[model samples]
Target: TGKKYNSAAANEAEEKINIAIRVIADHVRAVAFAIADGQLPSNGGAGYVIRRILRRAIRYGFTFLETREPFINELVAVLSAQMGDFFPEIKSQQNLVTNVIREEEASFLRRLDQGLQLLDNVIAQTDGKEVAGAKAFELYDTFGFPEDLTALILKEKGLDYNKAEFDAKLKEQKDRSRLANEMTTDDWVILTEGNTESFVGYDQLENTVSITRYRKIDSKKDGVQYQLVLSATPFYPEGGGQVGDRGTLKSINETIEILDTKKENNLILHIANTLPDNVNTSFTATVDADLRDESQSNHTATHLLHQALRSILGTHVEQKGSYVGPSRLRFDFSHFAKVTDEQLQEIESFVNARIQDHLPLIERRDIPFKQAVEEGAMALFGEKYGDSVRAIKFGESMELCGGTHVKNTADIWYFKIVSEGAVAAGIRRIEAITNDAVKAHFAQQEKALEDINGLLKNPQDTLKAVVSLQDENAKLKKQLELLLRDKAKNLKGELATELQEINGVQFLAKQVDLDPTGAKDLAYELGSLGTNLFLVLATADEGKPMLTCYISKELVAEKGLNAGAVVRELGKYIQGGGGGQPFFATAGGKKVEGINDALNAAVEFVTGK
Candidate 1:
């Protein structure tokens, strides 16, 4: 009875330990959610989080479920469904998650197969000695092969591995990874007991403010810098991907420069090289009015463009990310492929249509989040939202946003897409401009056109002038090709006469004054002359040797000669390599000096002498 009681007690303790471990894993999962909510993962940190979660889930599955197959996808579905309300991004991007996980699993499986093959090859070459598991583990980790798979393969080959050494190497890699990615956060310093950051820039450019708490931080690049907090700031902090506002703050007696404004942990951080000598004194904050207006115009234009894309492309488009600044605005969205030129033209036209309409900007503050969405306001992916939200609306475009916008769309004189390209596999980006930027862009275009017209002697019909020049260029190119073809035909006859007979086989080797394309044509022409023809042609064009080799069907079968292999071998003489069908192959080389050697190698390959 006493022994049974001891066993029961130990069993209960083990159960508790397992429960604690599970709870810790759940908490780690929650930390991932929190980080994701802050949009920290989407830009660059997402890959690390994804790998961490996958490894954790896979390890847990192996320990508890005793299954090696990937289980993270199922777990992700459950977690995403549970947190769908808070983060709709997860729900919307569920397909993306599936694709990423499936690809990772497939990649890992392929690596395992490759590792097994490599280990088998390695063990076969080993001279009756145990292979170090550390070396095996290094291949596993570096190449994403599972260690268990390696062990099983090694066991089948009657080879032992140093398991302890393998574990040590794996642990060392984990330690280095942890040290590199570890981050620490300091406690926040409250400047004021206020909940909201008030912006007076919409109606006014200057405001009176009290000095908030400031701290010095050290970074890798910039040695030391100070971040200041203000009770109320007129300077717009960098948000919505826009660059920060620059201005000056004047106290009763002295002035301090406000270099840039940025946001951290939902708090506005004003970066400055130096602090005011009077730390407790009150000061007036002033924003660069012109910069502020230009930024606001661009911000307003971005909102219109978002609406324009939906109008032109489809309702599926949503803002993935954005940067609104005085100079320009960059917006990212979800799209399978590049926007066609026709679609871009329509999108640009739609945005300009809104600008011409001069719709009034309507901003509704402190609206319920659900109500905002129900009202057809577009919400961005990977953005965290609270119960109350700020909704910005134009005539047809509405979105939950906090960035500054123009009061009226008319203020945005014109909208132009400066650049458009892909940011990722499924994400497309557009950089655009408005107002002054558009004017400047058009001014540059006008100057360029004027210079072109001047060079053309102010041609009355630019289209006619361009067509005439194109016709002349085409004619010249055709004449040059004809001249080269005639020259090659004449040279082919001379080369045919010079063919030497070797061991009852015909051989021809020469440097032809023809391009790679033309040389290949000549070789084929010569091969069709008769059977048992072995041809090697070398040409130097633009200081590079173009080597071509051809063997007739009869000689290829009789001598077991592969022109593909021969060219690959001979190409080394010319510092290049290539392969093709048994009949024909060509190679390019940087070493023009090796053309003769390459031809000689080909002759040696064909004759077998």
Candidate 2:
């Protein structure tokens, strides 16, 4: 049996359904990839990614699949069982995941139902004219309604929609997003096999290396720079948000300055201005010993800080990102809010305590990733791991890492936190330094403090000295305010006498010598005197002209006047624009001569002859 329906409406509905299906399929594939990597459904990076995907899928089903609420749960359960071996945590947390998805789905359905009611209002107000596809798409994108749902509701109301136009708009947005995230890389050239790079420079400063493979790349700022992969280079590649290493790569005859070392794929590429003339010749690879030593100290200090955070804050604190360079180390971790001053002090004290203890660093190579975890080594949240990883431990502080480190915690000399703040929604970051950098940082601080103390005659207590000076400054400020108020009062009476009657309204226009704030206060006081009073004042201070306007409540209604519009129109003369309520407004101008013209315009507006 066939039900008579509009052929166009049916086709539009089918196209929307197809697009939703494609979105759902892409999400499913992303989940499958996460599972293949042995990542579990926990409250971390990969876990959050999976949860977001599942919630989106459930919302899509409610909007487009036209199935009941239980359909998404059933689909997730089926997928979980098929992939349970790869991610046992998914099955273990199935009930929790389902409950979360169902709750989100119910909430979104309620929002959609409310949005449909709003749509009906828009349609009724629009009076049967076909709504633009762009507007309809905006409603869907911002309010999370499927396009099919939009079309369905519009069809029920006897209105037409351009589904193709909506799809085109959607596609354009997707194209822009794709372009923003697209990354390109050139293919790697392999030079040697079985020549794994080592990091002996942590203990020793220099190493012997032969140049392996090198290539040239063109960048926006610097053109035609060479990138070389060396055999047994000592440079550490930048990872976990730290800047790369930079030093000298030299042969006996020629020297190439290494600007940076970074790892791409599994290869460490050394960036330089040019490659050495003899590609096959062996050379000395040297990292800046001072920088390397400082970096190692900071790197180990970060481990201590990480452990301190877990002990003082909670075990929930996980490393989100890190940067270990020659100068400083910046650490990012998962935390919901700002680290309090007391907590930060505690963390600082704890790391310094460990440094004082002189804890020896334990390095283990070629450890199985699973075994490392079983031994309670902390793996970073967003890092992708392989079958094997290197573990570094400073007593209880154990983590899977490959960065260079000091032989003992005492080598750190000192740890100092430079800054701490939020990096993202639930992530906080701490930037700190160690060794010579810490010494240098404190030296700079001491010099500044000395300068301040000298200016204050080297007070016995700096804090009390500064507090007394601040109190005196506040008293002086209060006296200045009182003087300004007395001046304003005198000016107000003189200004009131200057007011003239125009078109049966009290019109006052003048170019005052007062500042903008004073002029505004004067105008407001004048307006408070009586009804139908209009005031406009302009002042030229420091080669700039400022204007202020005020109108009484009755004058605004009688003249149909808007001070905001008047200020906007007058702003062109002054080269600045501003707006305010009908009762008050202001503008600033670069041309001092334009103040008179603006005053004339305001007078004409009030007179209205």
Candidate 3:
């Protein structure tokens, strides 16, 4: 159902204010859920989605509701108190949700301060009774302000906004996004009576199943695909952090290759290249044994790793998200600080010990969700569960899972942690290899070691040899820095000797052979030593001209000279731009010869001499 907004008020502006309130009420749910689901308000991906939603809601309250300071964070408590019973995850993750929202709110408030000026500019351009959709879009696209915020402001001015035109612009942008991330599908056509599908993939890899439904999809982005559904197949659909199984379906007359198995709202869609010739009859479905075996091994390793993380990084660690494939497994969990190298080694040892023990997986099915929770089977927050769920218990490691796993932990062979680092604000991700991926990993590491040994002439102590080289390089760097500093001190006198007076302002404009930092240092030295000084140091290092301006505090007050503004004007001559405080500024440009002209321009612009 669409979000229902029910608040009404007496004042004319109150109508707009209520609009913002309603939007905020509706959007806060998504923000709350996304945060509980472990997605933070970041600059990209799903976090970007959360950020946009929060900003939109805040923009409404900002424009119409007259809410200036961070107010949406307060509503988090109201949301928790209201819906906490139904969705307890929000209550559990309330602090995280509130903190993320508050941080995002504070950030957008800073943006809104800047955007208000942009909004005014957009509003001013449409002087007529109607604000152009293009103008409304500018406020949103450029400034990141909500469109409704613009509408509310326009309504206050008795101006109508072009919504239909705005929708077109919105659709154009959506089309661009859709094209980039497009997945076309065809309408399903039923071939059998039943709507249910079953997976017997745990016990068997091959089965003869009848086509329940089929569809031919032609996508402009992905091209043509034939999706078929079987009554009861052994194929496992992609879900629960596991990739879809790739296999084939065979009819009596022909064999149709199954590209991938995926689930969309409990419907397992078998993506294929071609349709079966005889849709009425049953066909033999087979899953590639080698692929599922490797996947299961990695999936089991992920479970062991999850337990190890909780043991290593405290019980605060929970599954944030994961990706299990034939090659490797990537596990994301909630933790504050970085996992140290020693901690990772310990984690690896823990998992490898479990693998070495050959712990049997105690697979329990049709277990009541509540009973399973009582049994201490760790349930992933935000994941929807049925009345009865499957729980995989490996000694101490227990989790509610439906994805295929190894019969025993020993099947994983070996576990190697590839990398460990932060994924978000409070989330850490660990990518690790299992089974054949481990063997491949070791092979690559061995090869790299061999290459390094060959490069180092097979040094008996490679670590000590490398350390000695690094020490030598550091000493050389220190010597070069000292030499450069001494050279700069000498060049300062030569540059200062060329000082000339213009309109009672002690002006010096000369081309110097120095790096940017060196040039800046020289300018500060001269400025600190002199009085009534207007210094402009120009340099052309590697044919890139740069200008630095330093004006005295007295002249800045008397002559109204701004060093930043002066350098910016000088920058135009050298095809560049810059700005700074009243006393000091710097600019960089392309034209080498223009450095002298830029200095002359600065003198004429400030002294008119």
Candidate 4:
């Protein structure tokens, strides 16, 4: 807090220095609070907003403060001390929040150094005082470099760019993004407006209900779609990291497939591609039982997994994000490092042990949020809780959740962690499968083992057989290299006698029977023997043609001969082009028949005919 802040030496401005201090102070609070609430800086959406704020703060420190090292993370302790009493999350998660910011600052500082070099190249290529705005935007879009930072660097060099052009490019990108995600909704067509809708999915999978209202939505992505609201529905809308339920609706006249279920403004909306023939008649709403059961298994497994992680890793671990679906479950949590292979095995074993214990689900339909928390229910930081919350518990694992779950832990036959990795600076993600997915995964693995065994000729010990085969292959490779070298040596002597004198230069152009590597070795060996020598060697291996050219340094300087230029000109015969230094070059092509023609034309470069 006592560090002095000032502008660059060239500009000794007091007001600018003060601005930098205030900017760092204000933006750091936003970053810290957001991280405590489980929002990490990333590349898109709200995550990107946090990232831009942090980078802007770091840029200020780098420019006006003249503080180049990672100093922004140091302010986190002060922020926690001042605001911790009122906002306890910052105090509890101070270390985690600090590390996330520190990583981001270090990463951006490295990029800032690279951006300076890139700007220098851009300035060198510019012939006038102005650089292209498109180039500046490319730095921002492609390389994560700030455009304003580019402008600032350019200004220091007495250069500027057209701001209007950059703004236009930015706007065009925004417009394209909006068009891709935009959708328009019409007013709800009221059918039976007096009846209120209620969700009965927790107790049943099918219920008889009537359409309360309907609306039509149009979007470029998903052309004309309809959303129908029912009087009483048994479909669970997507929320609490669980996917929406899918099923169908049937009336006396027609049947409509419900593609998905979602909630908006506390109203359950059933999405369908077409409207039913009789919206006024009573209909049977059925939720897909198989899909619902699979989702429930995964959703319940997440709770058990959360408990296992906290028990093994530490109490500091908190849920950042999750996705529970019919196929797999992905859980993101805050941790300082990678979950090691040993820890992952323990976590998996813990969850599977709970499944074997056959703990029954203890669900409370409605309870006061305060009372629920007082009873030691784990509430996620970012989620907004109302006056009442639904609590789900399985043995010692309890959390305030709105997602559907299984009746007992035994419903989850087995739990398997397939992968664990880091998604962001301090966030780790674990992807796992359960029930039918675990069965399929093991079956596929067994089949792969069988294939490997067959490839090894059903050996008594598969691993030993594989090791022996690898050793034999290595020995064969060495023998092949020796044979190729001998062949090149034999051809070298025969080709030396065939060299012809052209313009006081020793020249030879021929197609060799050896491979590309052998031809290159033979050309280099012949070139070392004499001065003013020019060589062109061509080889074809499996229908692919390779042309190698080597020119002596004396001839390259005296006769203006370039092996690169020569190969480029002659490569047209084989429909290929390549270039290298003035002394040596190589080209490859698809047309093997053109090898002889390319070799025949090499004499013109030496004779100028």
The true-versus-predicted C-alpha distance at residue 393 of model 2, in Å, is 1.2
Model 2, stretches more than 4 Å misplaced? 1-204, 539-545, 588-594, 607-609
Candidate 3 structure quality by residue, lDDT tens digits, 205-277: 9999989888888776668888888888898899999988888898889888888999977788899877877
lDDT of 3: 0.82
Model 4: per-residue Cα lDDT over 1-609, one tens digit each? 344555553454677787889899999999999988878899889999999999999999888777667889999999999999999989988999999999888889989887876676567568899989888887887777888888888899899987888899999999999999999999999987575999999999999999999999999999999999988899999998999999999987788999999999999999999999878899999999999999999999999999999999999898989999999999998888989999999999999999999999999968999999999999997889999999999998679999999999999999999999988888899999999999999999999989999988899998899899999999999999899999988888888899999989999999888788888888888898788899999988777888999999999999999998888778888988666788999888878889889998999998899
How many backbone clashes does every candidate have? 2, 1, 0, 0
Candidates by lDDT, descending order? 4, 3, 2, 1
Sorted on TM-score, best first, the list reads: 4, 3, 2, 1
| TM-scores, all models, native as reference | 0.69, 0.71, 0.77, 0.79
* Candidate no. 3 TM-score: 0.77
lDDT of 1: 0.74
Candidate 2 total steric clashes? 1
User: What does the lDDT read for residue 594 in candidate 1?
Assistant: 91
Off by over 4 Å in 3: 1-50, 56-91, 102-172, 178-184, 251-255, 276-282, 508-511, 535-547, 566-579, 587-604, 607-609
* Each model's lDDT: 0.74, 0.75, 0.82, 0.90
lDDT of 2 by residue, 532-577 (tens): 8888889887888888888888978888877766776676677776
lDDT of 4: 0.90
